[model samples]
Target: MDVNLQFWSTEGKSFFQRFLHWADILDPTVLLNSNKKIEKSRLLLQTNAQTLQEPLQDKKVKEAWKLSLSSVHPGTGEIIPLVFRPPAFLPLATPLLFASLLPHRGAKQAIIWQAFPYFVMTQHKLSGPMQTFFKRILPIPLLACLSVFNVMIVRGTEYENGIEVMDKNGKVIGVSQKAGLKAVQETALSRAALFGTAVIIPESLLYFLYRTNFLLRNPHALTPLRLVMTVSALGAMLPVSFSVFPQLGEIKRDDLEKEILSSTEETELFYNRGV
Candidate 1:
């Protein structure tokens, strides 16, 4: 009994030590310090600073460092710490934090649209594998449609008064309803493409993982691994998806209504192609 107690105590100490090591590695402060060091070194080289303190004294360098340490509003130039920036930090920390916790009607609709079809499909008497296959395939198109719908709803309403028709000198001319609608449509198509890729690629990889019984082999780690895979797939595709569409939507003067073209100074018009 004494020998057994000693063995258990030794194992407990080992487990505690491993946990501490991992905790240190995962700590945000550790990551922050490492980032700060690398950035400071870069700044020093760029500015030809004799010391770190010299670089920090520059007003622009100070602002840039602050921006690097946190999130900033591109339009307003408002700087907020990572913890304060709900959009960036919340999604990284909690997968469904904004979906469930926030008062976003669009997010709620997206969840329902993605979920309701699966619930209905499950009611029918289908084989387990068949049900799984249908569950994966059906949501892809639904999500794509939802993405388009969301884009139209958000951008359509925002530009309901018509987008500002700018001249070559960036002066605001008369608004153009047709131009606004065209911009919204372009954004909607782009969103549909992004959603389709994000859903299809991850689901395809997940299907293969299941077929190989990867989850079964590591049953305890299944949920975490699946979450990691989904997040990673979306993260990898997000930049590529965004780059697929130009943010500055363009339209020819001929495409606009006769009145709008005659009123505007420029031969061509541009509007914001929202994400």
Candidate 2:
């Protein structure tokens, strides 16, 4: 069974189970695995006679799965980009906080920086609109749109190549573009939700925290406090955001296009919804 498909599978599983696995997948250590190691793990599973119904009692199989899943791409069979991998997302993004939050050195940079947080308000700020009103909002609708556009540009071929769809027994059926689009859409939504919750919540919380008695008295504490809030928010929201949709999404035979439906009589087909 492809690990991503297994994760996306909703059959008899609850949200909590998926969330826990997602947490493991997002662990930073997985980013350290080499291509050789991932191939070894995949080969181990392939040689197992019972791979069709895996998660065997052998603890090695389970560990191998985590490594393979974290490093290898489900549809493409290629190593995920170092910075873009799920586990590396937080680690890589953390350093960016300094640049994002701290004051910039030049006028042009300051203009762009100020526009990002309360972008809607920045344009109107010149017209004397209230800062309080604008500070409370983010351009999330625009962010989500851009996020989707990015996936379309970066991995447009995946939709045409199609994501693998499977049956209940972990057997491969066929690939379909319809299923691929759903997976890509869900993944994009999750990415947006992740950033939105991570950014908006911490900023909101810290905005109030800065006014509190303790923070007001110790101004130096706010910098570390904001970093901690960002990490906490990102770590906590990563799994929850991805779990918004099943990793393995279902498309009914009736709903599928004739290309796939004509081959399989199975009413429920599963596709690996991209992470």
Candidate 3:
């Protein structure tokens, strides 16, 4: 089996095992590795996979797996763009988060909404749904919506290209659009959940922290503190969201569309759920 395929196969692990697996892959340091190193890691895994289940364990092999998996697309075997890669997400979002956290912007929103009643039965100042959306917990869901939209725009071609289904022997059997859409949908939801948690938790934590005397006593700590929280949330959630759905999704032969069904006699097959 392809190492990537093996990683996501049903035999791989339970949720906790998958969580630990992704935690290694999602390490941001993978972004620092050179092209040469990534190829070497791929080679190591390939050479050792048949002989060793753990694959010649050592720091080099381990780090190599991390860099290769995180940097390269499992489906296409291409280097994912820096910004779009999971490890790079925190680095890209952290600074903008800090800027958004400036007191003036939040103060403006709080001031405008402060006077509005929590529950306005009159429905004149603002409609009930509108008020709840803007003032309540819906901001996270809205961000999730945008996450789905972005995924569609950025990687829509994967849906069109269809997934290459493979037999247990690792031979390509056929392409299936059903498998492809499932992968994309799961990825979209995972991304939404990831960013939603990342954004909401830090702000909520800092909102309370802002009132504490510690921040007042040392305003300089705010920058590092914000960085810590954002990175921590991503560290915790990336594994979860990635593991929420299997990266290699399965389709029973009976469930596939008529066109895809005729290509293989096997009762079950697998497709790469691109990261």
Per-candidate clashes, comma-separated:
0, 2, 0
Please provide, for model 3 over 149-248, each residue's C-alpha lDDT reduced to its tens digit, 9 standing for 90 to 100: 8887777876787778888777888777777777788889888998788768887787688767778888899878887887788667778888887777
Better of 1 and 2 by lDDT: 2
Which digits, one per residue and each the tens of the lDDT, describe model 2 over residues 71-115? 777766677787778788778866664345554444467434345
Give candidate 1's error at residue 270 in angstroms: 1.5
Q: Evaluated with lDDT, which candidate comes out highest? A: 3
TM-score for predicted model 1 compared with the true structure: 0.60
Candidate 2: residue 4 Cα off by (Å):
5.2
Worst 10 residues of 3 by lDDT: 110-119
Alpha-carbon lDDT of model 3: 0.70
Local distance difference test, each candidate: 0.51, 0.70, 0.70
- Models sorted by lDDT, best on top: 3, 2, 1
lDDT of 1 by residue, 1-275 (tens): 11111112222234343233222222344224344553553343345433233424676554443333233322233444445442253245336522321122332354654456545654675667777654556767876787788778877764576775554444555677887888778767766776577556656776688889986787776566556655665555444444454444557877777778777657776554434
lDDT value, candidate 1, whole model: 0.51
Off by over 4 Å in 2: 1-12, 50-56, 101-107, 110-129, 139-145, 160-162, 169-175
